[model samples]
Target chain A: MHPEPSRSLPEKAAPSLTGWGGSPAGPTTLLRPEKMRDFKPGESPQIARGMGRGYGDAAICGEGHTVLTERLDRMLSFDDETGVLRAEAGVSLADILTTFVPRGWFLPVTPGTKFCSLGGCLAADVHGKNHHVDGAFSQHVTSARIIPADGAERIISPDKNSDLFWATAGGMGLTGFITEVSLKLKKIETSWMAVKHTPTKDLDQTLDFLAIDDAENPYSVAWIDCLATGEKLGRSVVMNGRHAAIGEIPLRENNKLDGSFSKQKPMPFYLPSFVLNKFTVKAFNSLFNLRQGSRGEFVTKFDPYFYPLDGIKNWGRMYGKKGFVQHQCVLPHESARDGLRAILELVTESGRASFLAVLKKFGPEGRGMLSFPTGGYTLALDFANKPGLDEFHDRLDGIVLNAGGRVYLVKDSRMKADSLPYMYPRLDEFRKVLRQYDPSGKFASDLSRRLNIAGD
Target chain B: MPGIEGTALVLGATSPMARWTAYALARQGWDISLAGRDVQELRRIAADLILRTGATVSVREFQAEDLESHEGFWEDCVDQMEDLRCVVCAFGFMGSQDAQNEAPALAQQVMTINYTAAGTILMHAAKHFEEQKTGWIVGISSVAGERGRASNYVYGSAKAGFTQLLSGLRARLSKSGVSVLTVKPGFVDTAMTFGKDGVFLVADPKDVGGQIVEAMTKRKDVVYIPGFWRLIMFIIRSVPEKVFKKMKF
Candidate 1:
């Protein structure tokens, strides 16, 4: 049964919001609710927003309402012996790491950024470098409490309300407002990682290092130099890491599980647009290769190992006020090599230098219907927002579609509506679940509206 | 570091600042008693604290507006935890200035909760701590209390009363070996200022909570969260009265 509504409505304000990419800004009514009871649906359509790390329009609703879940963060309970934790969906992965890492526990699967809230992780079903080993974030979640359109709270798991569970797992907050989540955490001996970096000569070698059976480490990802061409195309630095055992660390580092790391320095202001062009990015790429290629093996803290960019707060501002878009797509194993080569060649030809490029391998298809991962190779590239960037991305999407690949919904801001069906074959199933739960489309976002995911 | 062996009673435990302060205290090895109007919410917070810190947590229903029951509430807290050595008052009401200006009742509610109710309970705490001759009391005041402004002077006036109350109590108990900390936070990213405009240099509640704990450990009397707020408030207080009255900030 539904609980009583809160005596007063949550604090509301109209704020101009944007995703992490910073492009496509719009004004939306934001509701900051402190408790579950305050999650009352109003006349306008609504979607839940966490830390706004989705990189696109998924968290922005425009004229609709965006219910912020950050304040709802609280650790509900934990099972020390079993390494299971129940926490409010608004709890950030950073908080979890701070609280549990020192106690010898770690997140089973975490995205590149720890600033993201648990609910956002579930909505996106985010994957990490260890996705080939541990699967997506939602796969580790045992159960969740969600407040759907009807305002009734439902506890869904993989076995109970399995359809709804799968739908909400990667539904992008389309099905409900995720309030709480319970997940199994991984146990670790230290808060550090033993990392090995190997520079690949070309695209083929990079793919070989990330091969499913050939992968020697639990976490693996490659930073590709997208500006390369011909024989040097896709030259990358492959980084592989595993949890450092107590014995593997130095004697002076006595607190093996010390989670404390260096503080973040804010990117004081937006760098001028001209500051990051092809010439500059290419130079930076060359220097990075030279510096990292020599660092063959080392022990590093988890913060820098997993989230190198997080060390610079608001690093996205470097993309300038106009912002940039991240296009991440996963191609099926059979056509991954060809697909990646074509995409890289196009990026090099277009002169849109992507300063940050990452490639990883995925395991089997995840349980979430719209989960982005599959047994394939995934590539993520960031491009500055320019006049012709939309047409450029369209061509990239065309190549991915031909290769039987799908674009990650969380990172997409301007893909065509028709591309949705081609990318996610399970769109019909996601739509079916939405119709059953929220027939009136109470929960909608700019992403859903642009792509017509609700089929309204 | 070893855990502190005393219990801390946190009033208005459901507020964001109180929740974080309680967490900071519990993490430092202090048992906690959470009191608030919403008993259900307090229970959830207590459970969370217990789970995270392995500290003993007790939930009690408290009505800040009911000044008469505060004395009994203090007794219950002392009865429940014999080693209660810290009391934190982290509760206040911020009514809309425009609405409070129109309704006398609204203004009264805001004044009573932020000043009268808070002051009454703190007096009881002051007596108990003074008698024990070894305890700490923390009051969460605001920078708004430092000056009167047209934007939120009603709420500011109440906070001003609270700030002075803490100041007076600190003076009265100076030689009693009991310490009182007056916390003046500016633009904290809490539920109270979640969507408010013109909020710059917003400090995270977690950091503010951690700083409060540090200040208490050092026995600091008055502190401005983020530290820079002291300079900002100092500049504001230095403005000439005629100029300040005409300025909108």
Candidate 2:
């Protein structure tokens, strides 16, 4: 039977916890902070978690405790004119949008889902479709307050405590517990997205479409059809979007506040795993391509444009009881095309039908020590964690390493420790920073131990 | 279910359940007056609520044993928050009966905080809401009061009186557009019970707080948190006194 998360608190131990992909359960003691005043870190090591949306163990502290930040959610202040906000790290993007959307403000850059917390976004230095324009999430952050191993709250910013600031940006909470964040917000005229879909015949055309400067939109993503092989390899639907201007929306409507959105319907139970096998997925991909090939420019709500899967609550459960492993990698622009094609071919050749695949172009890398983006093309694919898939993923990792690409830690649950230093050339620099900040290794986590990141 | 704009007063604000309730209502756009003994922590909670939801939150000086201080708070607080719509009382004392038996001062303090202090302050709150005729009073009592065991009946009996006060107030103020709710939370995980052994089916404070907030909004009365506690307490209360007296919880 699949593990059911009990609502009990004190009575619970060894709770089955997983990220969005829902694989590799970590044995952990759960702790929730009720008050921030006189808030101090316990003697034991810990990792702060909000909603646990990081796909893997980045938020899990295995042997140590996983501090639940749900109760810590609090939005502190906002500047109407400047579009700047300061909030507790536990505050979720959804909470921000619910309050700010009507007031004409949006997140600077958001990942695929709005369920993630500001701290989760910060620790991962997450990016979105606009990465080619805006950098990672940390770029817009002005400052933050963190409690280190000593339990002393210290304010870190780009200018003030520059060293600690840069180290904590993508230090993955190795620096300490981030208590608060001061961030600049993006102003939007309306919550509607004016989108254009350009269907490409092959991988080359997809890259060409993304490279077109004049036609480039502020937000861009491509849906890759991995089932198509040979000449039709990487056949994609390139979709670009920008916030809709005031005049572009229909007259006499509260476009800013009342962007049309449907009530989400939850998937009540798990569908069997075989439903996602090759034959069915191939049929779905062909139909998806055929339908998407003809879609032209249209105005849609930001909810659907930015988060399509959010329309179906618990959509991740569609992969069934075994859960899914999302393999996301980025190769520099120089080798992105060849590397992406090979990765897709590897999956198709292995006879595994991936339910979802996405491709995006990233801008220059940020100051984050472990930020996932480079000036590259990022490709994300999901494989249901069935038998033989673990070995298949190992082989896939080898391909990524050879091409000088690195898998995203937020999405990675299985990657060899040896591959880390090779993927990130500045590993030594980050290790030094980690040593300086966390002398006792007080911020131990399953991901850090697995990849030999800060726990080294 | 209510307007996103309004104000609330959360007494015993330092409790994990109360803190969660305050944040929950604030997120729904309610201004809150955080009343508790911890001035520093209460101020922090106030600042947090303000920052998190842009709600007007104030830290009011409160003492549970001081009955005189609870007398004149109603009109003063209502004036401070322009449109006060709800008042949630999440205050109590859970002292062991053994300690109370050895020291009458402990018994008096337990009775004072759990029932006397609550009733004294709530008398003013009930009047204020009744006169304004538009809000609710949430009283956080415990399920331990439902069927007092030998281990801790002094604390349970105090809560029982507190629960009855809310019921009477509910009946008295039903027509005045005022709601009185009694919440019976079962085994919550908080700082108070952090390391207590043999704790089973413990409720998450956030969940319990959320349930309290929802009940206040939906106008539910005499509710049991985590819902299952109703059945559990019902079974405990059903036992014959002689048989129940011999057994230990």
| Per-residue accuracy of model 1 over A1-456 as CA lDDT, tens digit each | 112212454355666688999996668988888766676666679999999999999998888889898888888889988888998889899988988898899999999999999999999999999988888998899999887888888999999898999999889999898988998998999888999989999999999988846445899999998898899999999999999988888757457888775699899999887888999999999889878877999998899998889999999999898999999999999999999999999999999989999999999899898889988999999998878999999999999999999999999998999999988889999999999989899999999999999885
So what's the TM-score on candidate 2? 0.88
List RMSD in Å for every model shown.
3.0, 5.3
Model-by-model lDDT, in order? 0.89, 0.82
Question: Candidate 1's error at B168, in angstroms?
Answer: 3.1
Quality of candidate 2's docking, in CAPRI categories? acceptable
TM-score per model (chain B)? 0.97, 0.95
- List the candidate 1 regions with Cα displacement exceeding 4 Å: A1-15, B1-5, B146-148, B197-200, B226-249
Query: DockQ, in order, for the candidates?
Result: 0.41, 0.31
Tens digit of per-residue lDDT, candidate 2, span A1-456: 112212233313555778788896778887776667534467787888888888878888887778877667777678877888888888888878877788788889999988888888888889999999998999999999988887888998888777777778877777888888888998888888888888899999998887765344789988988898999999999999998888776656566555345578898888798899888999998888888767888888888888888788888888998789899999988888888888989999998889889998988989888888988899999988899987999998888898898889899898889999888777788888778778888887888898999644
lDDT of candidate 1 at residue B168, scale 0 to 100 = 98
Residue B239, candidate 1: Cα error in Å is: 5.6
Query: Could you tell me which 10 consecutive residues in candidate 2 chain B have the lowest summed lDDT?
Result: B190-199
